[model samples]
Target: MDLPRKLLAELLGTALLLAVVIGSGVMAERLSGGNMAVALLANTLATVGGLYVLIELFGPVSGAHFNPAVSAVMAWRGELPRTALPPYVVAQLTGAVLGAWLAHAMFDLPLLQVATRTRSGMGQWIAEGVATFGLLLVILRAPPARVAAMVAAYIGAAYWFTASTSFANPAAVVGRMVSDSFAGIAPASAPGFIVAELIGAAVALLVHPLLSPPRAAGREAASPPSSPARHV
Candidate 1:
C-alpha cells in the first residue's frame, strides 16, 4: 500500500482505539458506583470489542499496527519498510492524543487535562513487560485469520492480570497521559511503561523464532513464510 494511505489507517485506527478505551473508562467509572472491578470490566469489554473491529477494519490497509513497539518489531523483521517506521510511529502517536481529546469532548470534560494517576513501581513495570511480551507473542504466533480475536481476548485478559492494566502500547501511554480519566496513566509513569513495553517486545521477537521449527535450506526457497496481518 502507499505510505499515505497506510499512515491514515494507522492514525485513524489508533485514534478510535483510544476513544473507546478512555471513553469506556470514563463511562464505566461514572456508572460503577465506586466498584473498581465492575468499572474495569466494563472498560475491558469495550476495549476488546473496539480493538477487534479496528484490527479487522484496518488490517488490509496498514497491517493495523497501532503501537510503536509492534511497528518497530515488524520493521526489524523486514515486514514493514525500515524507512516507514518513523512516520508510522508519528501517526500512531498523533492519533492517540487526538483520540484522548475526542473522548474528553464526548464526555464534556476538560480537553487539556493531564493524568495524575500514578502507575509506577517494580511490580507495575514487570507487569507491563509481561503484558507486552505476551501480546507480541500472540501476534507473532497466531494464525492470520484468528489474529484479531486472539489479540482482543489477550488484551482483555491482560487488563485484569497485569498490574499496570497492560498499557503495552507506547501510543496508548501517551494518549492516556493526557487524560485524567480512570484509564489514564500519569506522565511521570509513562516512561517506565514505555521502556518495559519495548523490552517485552524485543523479548518476544527473540522467543518467536524458537517456537517455530527450522526450515531446511531447500524448502525455505520453495515457500516464503507468512506474516500476521494485524496487531494492536
Candidate 2:
C-alpha cells in the first residue's frame, strides 16, 4: 500500500478499535453497574473482534496494522516497506488520541470517572509483557499460514484467559491511557507497560528467523521454512 493509504488504514483501524471497546465498555458498565470483571470481558472481546474484522477489511490496504508496535514488528519481518514508517506511526498515534477522546465522550457520566484499565505492581507488569509478546507472535503466524478465523479466535481467547488482560499493543496502551475509562491505562504507568511490551517484542524478533521467511537459488532460507506460530 502507498503511504497515504497505509496512514488511513491506521487511522480508521484504531478508531474502529476504540469505538468498539469504548462503546461496548460503556454498554457493559451500564448493564452491569461497573462490574470490573464483566466490563473488562466486554471491552476485551470488543477489541479482539474489532481487530479481526479490521484486519480482513483492510488487510490488502496498508496491511491493517493499527498499532505502531505491530507496524514496527511487520517492518522487522520485511512485511512492510521502509518508506511507510513515518506516515504509519503518525496515523496510528493520531487515531489513538482521537479514539480516547471519543471514549471519554461515551462514558462521560455525571462527574463519573472513565472506564480505564489500571493494573500495576509486579503482576500487572508481568502480565502486560507476556500478553504483548504473545499477541505479536499471534499476528506474525496467523495470516500467511493459519486461517484468519484462528487469528481472531486466539485474540479473543487471550482476553478471556490472560491475567494482564492483554495490554498487548503499545499504541493501544498509549491511546487507552488518554482516557480514564474501563480500557484506559493510568498515564503514569503507560511508560512502564510500553517498555515491558517492547522487551517482549524484542524477544519475538530474536526467534523470528527460525520460524519462517527464506530462500536462495531454489533453496529455502528459514530453517524451518514454516510460518509464524500463534501464541495469543
Candidate No. with top TM-score:
1
Q: How many clashing pairs in candidate 1?
A: 0
TM values, all candidates:
0.96, 0.82
Error of 1 at 212 (Å): 0.8
User: Model 1 over residues 114-229: C-alpha lDDT tens digits?
Assistant: 99999999999999999999999999888788999999999999999999999899999999999999999999999999999999999999998777767743463366544425
Q: lDDT per model, in order?
A: 0.93, 0.67
The candidate scoring highest on lDDT is: 1
Model 2 regions more than 4 Å off = 106-117, 143-147, 212-232
What is the per-residue lDDT of model 2 for residues 22-141, given as tens digits with 9 covering 90 to 100?
Answer: 677667777877577888777767766777777777766666677677777766655666567667788888887777677667666432344345567777777777776666776655
